[model samples]
Target: MRSPQLRDATSPTGCALTATTALARLPALAPCLPEFSDIVPWPRRRGCRADAVVGWGQRPTTARARQWALRHQLPFIALEEGFLRSWGPAAEGYASHSLVVDHSGIYYDASAPSDLESLIEHGRISPEDELRASGLIARLRHSRLSKVNHAPDIPLPASPRPRVLVVDQTRNDASIVGGLADRQRFHQMLDHALTRHPDADILVKVHPEVIAGRRQGHLEHAGRHPRCQLLADDINPWALFDAVQAVHVVTSQLGFEALLAGLPVTCHGLPFYAGWGLTTDHLRCPRRHRRASLPRLFAAAYLHYSRYANPYTGAPSTLEDTLDLLEDQQRHIDAGRGHWRCHGLSRWKQRFVGDFLGPKACVSHHSQGRFEPSAVATSTERQLLWGSQIPAATGVSRMEDGFLRSVGLGIDLVRPLSLVIDRCGIHYDPGRPSELERLIAHGRFSPRELARAARLIQQLRQHKLSKYNPHHEPSRLPELPGNRPRLLVVGQVESDASVRLGAGRIRTNAQLLREVRRTRPDAFIVYRPHPDVMAGVRQGAQVSSDDWDRLVADVDITTLIDRVDEVHTMTSLTGFEALIRERRVVTYGMPFYAGWGLTQDHVPAPDRRGRKISLEQLVVAALIRYPRYVDPCSRQLINVETAVQLLASARQNPPELTLFQRLYRLTRRYLHGPY
Candidate 1:
């Protein structure tokens, strides 16, 4: 044996020249030496003492040489961080020696910066160094350097089941290193691998930095499974390659290493090694070439490698191990739970102050059993609690109290009654309407004044009728014969009054009267008010005769006409009545009748045949197709059937006037505006 001559070197460039000089002295080392850079040609001699020489760096030449060694099955050593930073955590098991070289020359302290300048000054490492040679000593100390001369020649393990290794960097919390989808798939693939290979041992290698406590847990449930062995301690990954059969991963660079080891790899996701004709891919890679070679694959990786720059150091690491390390670092950061503290805070603030004085609180309390209020009482109190055309009555003290309590306000200047009246549709801007109307002859009184005036007008009309005729007219008039079919109109008269009066309801009335008169010269069209409309009337208050007259005048149908032989409608309950009365009915739209093949419908029902259907069935489908009754205050949907049942029960056992007043008071507090 002879001592190799040591040469002084300056730059990393100088180190290469010095290495060439050293190789010149030891002609036996030529074979082990990596293919020289463009500056140095291949040695003329065939036989050399050096079986192989390994180098590590975050550059193209060092990476190319690493790939060449793997392709040639040459034993090589690599620092874990350099390899991870180049290719990712998956490359940990690929090389003969996987060493962790901390920046401070410590074994596992990744926080320290490398002493590359000191090494350069000492001439031990060159100034033009491709990588920090200071860490190399530490790496070699912890690595399988003694076995490099005579690499172990163990055969691949023989197992009936497939061998799989899961490589990931752990963090403080049990989260997957990759994105959500990647994490989920990784778990699924792990489960699949275990199920497919029941007797197989799945090796899970934690990132060296993660094992050293720089990061946290990333494996989650995968790390705890009986089949999985967490490789937290430092061990030569190549030894596992000799023991295991195959490798499984989720886009890990380990797939590439497994390929070099001549081991089969199953990739659950699109890793850089996937679609390179190297691994058994579980996912398709869009950038994959149809026919891939080692050199072509390297070209693709090298070309795309320029896109990334290390966020921490701002340096670029093109080597496979370097990319792996960088990716693992990012994964560690992402998996940490503290990363989401700011995000959670932002969302919490948004929802906290969104609704300070809205219907949501009232409804939420009512739904949660903290409060109970009758539906009718709620509706009536709502009408009065908020200012409306009608003034609050003296006996409605309880209602006022309830409104105040509901709004969390006392009887101050800002009373609930005042707020309601101020905000109500009719009471808004009282001064403008009253002052302007009184000043101008054409102007009308304020809504409150108008309501009072209307009441007086109705009283006078009733007084005159009582003073004269002394008898009220029959609610329904006698039926009459008509040339055209007679039609009846009905439904939510107040809400859809404009539409019904303008369209089908009025049209049916006018057309029936005209056609009947033109054909038989004598026919009748009946207009029936809804039961709910009639029930809305308050006793002792005179009806608006003018409003009634106006409604009749707007429709061309004759008010005197009574009998309805045929009915036309949109979705009015009058159609249902007409159906019960055996009058022929025609539906212009999907007015529920259009589907029941019984009536002459203008619109055809796509789902219904000529089959007769019960009125209850029609009502159920229309009202209960997953119907949700939303609380006007809360805007949250309540159980539809429960609401309906409550309404029916209330109708069956109507509350007394005193009980009603109590309920009105209680409900007024919770009733604000319709949500």
Candidate 2:
């Protein structure tokens, strides 16, 4: 019994799929359990009741599952891996992304009608589904995703004229058997490719397990034929798709992937996608009577039948979320230049920094005199300094809190899910250009990118998130005279690096408020202290209540910004947030957002930042492109959208502070500096 070691967190449902408990004999059913609710293990679910028997599709357990279902007079469910599986092979113990639960039959079994086949045949493929399918197909092409998404993209092997790809599968694989294929069929697949494309180069692509040496493939020795070259490297399918003109397969998932890639596919056996008129097939499934379009097939197979789950949080997630998770993992794996050495990292930081930097990171708190001879890493190592900026040095990266940072203040020792590591210069110090600035000036904010930025803006405003997503307590103000423009002065940590570098003549909160008063004496001034200052973890300038009409003890940032007409800031990210909310922002100094034709600049614009930019463009650079985000629970780098989703989730269900967390807050004052 191949009960895979896939248990991490048990399903929140606590029972099996359907009202009748499912006797899930395999751990592979875990991803599917969340959607169907209640999941119970084997013997526990065994009873005379109308329970269902379930097993992974067409593996060694299918016969056992069928017998159990037949003897007990209960139904059976066939589960299989979905289209986008994971970052690594299932045999290698990586978690799955999605699963397909078949009540009638499995997808690979073309002899009978499966839910996917039924959906393809009679399912209503709405215009909306087609539209979404078009987008999904585009995403599939862009992501270059396969059933297994482990390999890195490499340059295509240069072969002769027209390239024909022959996909190889492991011996007696369920799909092959269900497709009515055997070792002879794989040989036939290769032979057909070689004969049909006589003048073309036939690239025989081996299975990932074959490349791992875990299983032998039928075409591993295809190189024996001069015209047929064996693809031994664990090459990414997308990369191979770029070079291959057509694909030949015996029910391998790669054939479906090729069809999705817009490649002409010839299936030697009756795969689920074959007889539906999506691909040319040697054998036909008579049950598949309808001619389905590519989008319709994809819609039925991926969107309708498959269930997606977030590998990190064990929460029910969308296909887009899983794709984001895989993309992030792949990017980080590629981002690894060498080993990472974090200098003077604290225990609190040590726990989470590695979640950003991959597992190759080695953290050494300054107290560890072990490797402290200068603390700078050698050429092959990336040096990381926490919280503060390092002197401009090659390979030494500075880490700081991101703009859409957290639900609570970082000074309070709350875990930050996002951080921006800048190699050029920090975003706040406009004295020199940061990587973010470069992205803003040079990045092609395509329609897709702008749309993402636009979504992020809505998430921020809708969820009311900021650098420190402070509580949304509405503050009452003293009644003011009629029609006076409300000017909001945002305070910043005086000793903070942003104030030290970005602030010019009017540096302090008092100075900013006085300037606002001098500029618009008739305006009703509202001053909101920075959360870090309010928490007493950082220093702030002493200002009497007379400087502003309102102290504004407890107010939501977005709500306050919405009520005000204009915001005055000396490099406060509130200025950026206010800008996101479409409020007129007046900056006393040059923030990264200033000088981009977005804000009212009180100081001369930085010479390097003269380009005019839209609000969407600025967001695409700073939030989407610049900062690296990770889910706190999963400790995996996530896309900004996932980050926003996480922040929104955390806001709705705020976790109660453990005793240690409450204690950690007390010592934050000491650690906020120099740690």
Candidate 3:
């Protein structure tokens, strides 16, 4: 008796008790036993109810028994070993079913062996299973069948030239048409075959789902070929088999069907059906060890009787049937309509959601019919608000409605100031009226040299600002009842110094804290590390502390301040938020708002520094100047306002840029004097 393993083997219905012992017991307890050979007769006394009988025997005996069972309408299970032994070692037998058996003596049993064998001989496994298991037969009843159905009835054309059929599914959504590797390869093979055989009619059948309007076809280039005819009309594959002399494929299952038809197949890739002796191989299989004949190969796959349940009905069916039914269900689902939730009301919903409601409205502006405040604003209103002049040679109009519309649509509008600043980090020196005259007198500068003048002015502006704001006033520091004036710096801590070009001496965070403490001994410096910094990519385990004292311990620093009323940052949302609270801001980098003569800028201003602009204008410039806004849902680039709404959710949970802010100040001190 076979001992049952505690783990139940799954069946279509559910788990069933399966064991060698249970099977052995079947012969003894069967109530209606089939006529058995004298060599292995059933025990007559232990009668059990079994609907049918199956057993091992010689080929002649098993065949005779199978005939009798079929006549009596009884199910018969044949032991595979007898067939293999009778066929002899030279005979490969059926390739598909060869590997069905396991070492445990468990073998797959096709419900009707004779029917399954006939289907395999006809090379109709996929379609036959689809008809038997899914409502595909019923669906076909509503549609027209091709004129030809059987292999023999289909007549070959007068020409004996090889015809190649290329099959591929095109509805995969992850890629665009002509983008998938398999699809591209299939087209390449088709082109190669057509170029080789110009007269050959390449019948390209669209996948059934794509034909039925259940999915979109990705093969847009299919129509361009003069020799290729797209089979949009309902035509059976058997009909196609009669027309085509040969087949070429990348990895379609049709290659398998072509083999069963005895037609030569050229595989560009190693599909499951390609390696076995069944098909004429054009491509070598990478997995050389597992190749076998078609029948034995399939027997191992289909005859193995583990039933899969339907997701919708929860009823058991063969694995083949389960897939067919699932595809059918998907087709039906794709044909139906769907509902969508409104996204227009997102801003209203976002406001009441939590503490992360982004930067408060510091200023508001009027547009055509709409009154809204820019969510992200800087204190220097003019630099953020005004539009710059366009040059005549550039053929650009600053006031062109279309140009404004383009800017509003999120197109990068190149401003004279922005171009100069980005290139040389400088702006014009208005205070030195004769500065341009001096350059002209020295023959050192021209109209093109105005850009050089701007850079010098920007450097002077940064120098004067840094000199005056050397240290924060102790009185201006929030009254936290502490002897130390706490300064909080927030932003990206590590620079290219840590990654590409390794500079060993630059300890960015350490240098910044040391400089700030040196400038104001009475102030406590709190270093809040960037969230991205603490993500554990590098900098070792030492960088993981939020505690001020722990963060600034080894650097020349005063006591670390943990919390503060004022926050400083470079391009961090915290900077914008801090400004809404009316806190004095000192910026290290020329993030969009810096150098409008607004917040103290670390970098020199641009050459054509525009008048002080509003926060809205700055937001608009950055949106139009820097990165393009790509819509996630539609995959289209949208305007700045749309980009703003997309990023507005960041306001709800504004992050602190502790590490970056500290590093910027540290770099400044290192470049200026001593850290």
Candidate 4:
């Protein structure tokens, strides 16, 4: 249990080390670490092998390092501000600003060990801790991200009349991305606010994203009413909330923040905070059918759901730490250096990309193969595409792929809330030996991890969630023949990167189905084509007239999976989806999940996957450990749990689209082509 020394530990598994400034903060543990300095330039860190790495959370540098770590069975410990909000040592899957990282485990992963439940169950709130928690709530509200740093000092109205604030979210954001009513809901809320509080002057606070010109908002052409003023001023949200008579929101977290600030909040849309009795909610959620007090809600959301950090010192933090960091950051902002500043080619690209980033966005592309080599890398503005165009750079493909996603033909930004900038690559690529594969094979599986995974698996199964959701209602599954095993042969785009990479010998969906048929002739075959193929955006393996006689393609995969007893794939994620349903999965080629004992493999398993893992362990590695997530609204890093919840909610609610998205969907044929 003693603090580890660099030389004293040669990683038991010999996983490569990917250290960032996080190691510098832990000088006492430095001598025990290996020489990473020898590896000049960040991209080359991919080749270095160490059991574990220490780095700052969530930047291209650390993200790439994490990608490498995950792919090679290397443990990645990300450091950020602790939940208490000062520079205290913290570790989680990635450094999404809102994530609460416990060295023992992450708060989002319910399976990870936590004390929240015990505290709540036992009513063991220490008077000191309770006081601290309450004080922490006030501090967080005063110094929240939407409030602190770079916000202008806008004077409030001196009128005696009460002011009701209606928080307007960005047109396309995480709240919408995660599954809330779309941009139109904000407009409806505006109309409701006008009707509900005619006596009170209404102020609509525009989201920071809209202010920064990344996307549009509902209030753009509302034509200011005498009682309503569209406040596009980049002022502190907390300040606005403090001055407001009451707060109204569709699904913005500001409503939750306002509640923490001890203000009355009315929620028109269902956010995580709605339906908990704290807010006067229009939406009734079955999940949160119970009532809870402000302190309890605060504990669950802030203490349990978020990890904090001290901006000045790189150490584990608390409210005290945040206070100091906030002061320093505010000072920097006042001095005009607090915002993210970028130079170089990355900045150039950012400008060309139509300013999708927020006001604090800063990017730089420095020469010498690294962006800003000497300057300290911050969590503020992320640096990207450094040396990417150069042939010598290791991450050219990743950079190129990312660029394509951002500006590629036919693919609209609305569809993707978070980007997988880590080594796992894109969501669908099973071809590369992603960090997901590494986690499956070598990640330590705790009982808690397994339990969390089990719950997530259950949720996915119960909800029938799939990657790239088919928008239409699932067709009613045909009755299965008595006593015959149903085998679902999922189809994939033959031209897709996943198939090109993972489908070693059997490259086509038709071939995979044929192989499954050849192996299981007695089993009924249900071939569900890829949704992209169904949409005509891409082509799946062409099932010639000869093969069409035996395969069934009309049933929805979501409903179809329920009737199937087995799933067979070369490398489609459908196999993983089936495994979650407790359906037996037979892999024809090596997928990241293939070697892990979960699925039956046709190809020889890699020697690296000798250790048998449970379903939850696989979920933790693939879902939690592997991907990088971001909040679409706040445009900051978020945890996998948040992403999953958002995905599930969005699936159920399915937000209304903006005019552009609707138009894009309608004219998709003209917009789409091979990139």
Strongest candidate by TM-score = 2
Winner by lDDT between candidate 3 and candidate 2? 2
C-alpha displacement of 202 in model 4, angstroms? 49
lDDT of 4 by residue, 465-509 (tens): 666443455554576765877777777767665666566678887
TM-score rank, highest first? 2, 4, 3, 1
lDDT of 4: 0.55
Residue-wise lDDT of candidate 2 within 501-597, one digit each (tens)? Answer: 9899987888878878888988899888987667656656688777898877477777788888899999988899899999999999888899989
Writing each residue's lDDT as its tens digit, candidate 3 over 1-675 gives 111211233321211111123233332212112122121223421243333435442234445545555665655554332111111121222111111112122221212123223333343334334333233222222321211111112343555555667665555422121121344566667777787667787767675567677776644456577777676654445556667878876555556556555568876655545555666555553434344555444443333322232222222223333333223222222211122111122232222211111111122222222311242132232111111221111211111111111111111111111111111111122222121112222232222123323332333222221100112223433324356655776534445221112112323554444544555556555665644344333232233232243232121111112245444444443443343333555554434344555566554654535456443333323323222232233222233233233333332343343575556445543453211
Identify the runs in model 1 with alpha carbons over 4 angstroms from their true place: 1-162, 171-181, 208-214, 295-675
User: What C-alpha lDDT, on a 0 to 100 scale, does residue 317 get in candidate 2?
Assistant: 60
Which has the better lDDT: candidate 2, or candidate 4?
A: 2
Question: Where is the poorest 10-residue window by lDDT in model 3?
Answer: 411-420
Candidate 3's TM-score reads: 0.25
Prediction 1 TM-score vs. true:
0.24
Instruction: Quote the positional error of residue 143 for candidate 3 in Å.
Output: 18
Worst 10 residues of 4 by lDDT: 399-408
Model 1, residue 111: C-alpha shift (Å): 30
**Model 4, position 239: C-alpha lDDT score:** 70
Candidate numbers sorted by lDDT from highest down? 2, 4, 3, 1
